[model samples]
Target: MAAGAIPATKLAYFDNMWAVQATATLLSHLETEDGRRALILDSTIFHPQGGGQPADTGFISGAASGFKFVVEDARLKDGLVYHYGSFENPQDDCVSIAKEGEEVSLYINPQRRDLNSRLHSAGHLLDICIRKMGLSHLEPGKGYHFSDGPFVEYKGIIPPDLLQIKSKELEKEANALILAGGKVSAPVLSYNEAAECCGGVLPSYIPTDSAPRIVKLGEHPGCPCGGTHVADIADIRNLTADAPHTNGMP
Candidate 1:
């Protein structure tokens, strides 16, 4: 409950997006102010909801007691990952089923993870298509990769005349690249290396001295990201892009 009580969780997903199961040491099991149970682990494969991607849902079971905790949602706050869910069978007295320092096995829903990874990867591919189509002026902005209706927003405006044509072209180019296929990679690099990989510039928000994880799709330029992605571009299978719209950019 204290601010510094637990250290930042090690992100296992960052290194291997395809891993569906992993083992971790239980750090703390607490009930939130809202009465929801939260599990903290020293390392986690669960991807939290952020950066336009939804949180992963799965289950964590204690190896010793066989107690199961259903992870309805996961969130990251102040560098700690909170696995929010209720245990399959809470003790009658309300004592936590998981104990500190106990080893637990995490099993993420593979179907959900696969879909999320594909949607997230498709967004990056769309960015590549935008640049390749010579719409580089439309600076990338927020991205919503939810399954309901995934779309990437841009900071700049497109001319009324080109809106329809550009959207079609973007969709065409994206599918073409997906068909051709290319290996996808995300590697941690020094600030300078990351900047070089990202066309000689890193976003201002990234710390100057910190090594950032850069995701690259084949020969296309890399970008700094802190999310999971597919192993190859072709894994996306197909993609469609709608005409870009603006909220209030003039």
Candidate 2:
């Protein structure tokens, strides 16, 4: 460690709730070999690539300037948040850079964020529905919440005869929750409290005494998570589920 250096990026998106437009201080910068220059922020409203969701892309500019930099990616590393993108530099067009410690405004692409959020939330809701199906034995696992083709993987096998029935039931329950307009109610809780919300079984990666971020749909039980989400259940539209392959999911 340095004699005196900040250890990592302070995250703001956790408390941002739903901030599409915000501001932060430029903490540092990096230029990748691919030619993309990434700006690190002291505190960020950007959601980094973690929790099975993709990073958020947006723009970072001087507090009052027209357009200083275009942020293309946000990532979390060792507690630091990196915003990767380019800017229109006044000095030259070849490269764009920002001074560290300068105040900068940030904005996330609304359309992209909306889709990502909805799908991510849908994945969570699907997990809950799976439990409701009396097949909790399936055991939830990895989730691909990307907008292109999102799905939740489970550890147990579904009897081949129940595939179609299960798929249809999943769609119906997921969509029912959407139409029901369940209010979102995610809150951070102490380790014990969080564990209880997750049915008293925290994921293996979570320490027994570590506080965790949780997400819940309306009155449903909350699950620990770290991804942006739609404000309400209704925000997720046209959610569908595909039948598990005979060979099972990857």
Tell me, by TM-score, which candidate is best: 1
Clashes (candidate 2)? 2
The TM-score between candidate 2 and the true structure equals: 0.90
For 144-184, candidate 2 gives per-residue lDDT tens digits of 98877788888888788889888999889888888988887
TM per prediction: 0.95, 0.90
Q: Which stretches of candidate 1 lie over 4 Å from their true place?
A: 1-3, 247-250
lDDT of each: 0.89, 0.78
lDDT per residue for candidate 1 within 1-250, as digits (tens), equals 3436999999999889889999999888888888888899999999999988999999999878668899999999999999999888577633354678889999999999999999999999998998998889988889998999998888787887777788889899999999999999999999999999999999899999899999999899999887889999999999877777656422
Record all residue pairs in model 2 with backbone atoms less than 3 Å apart, i.e. clashing: 9-79, 9-80
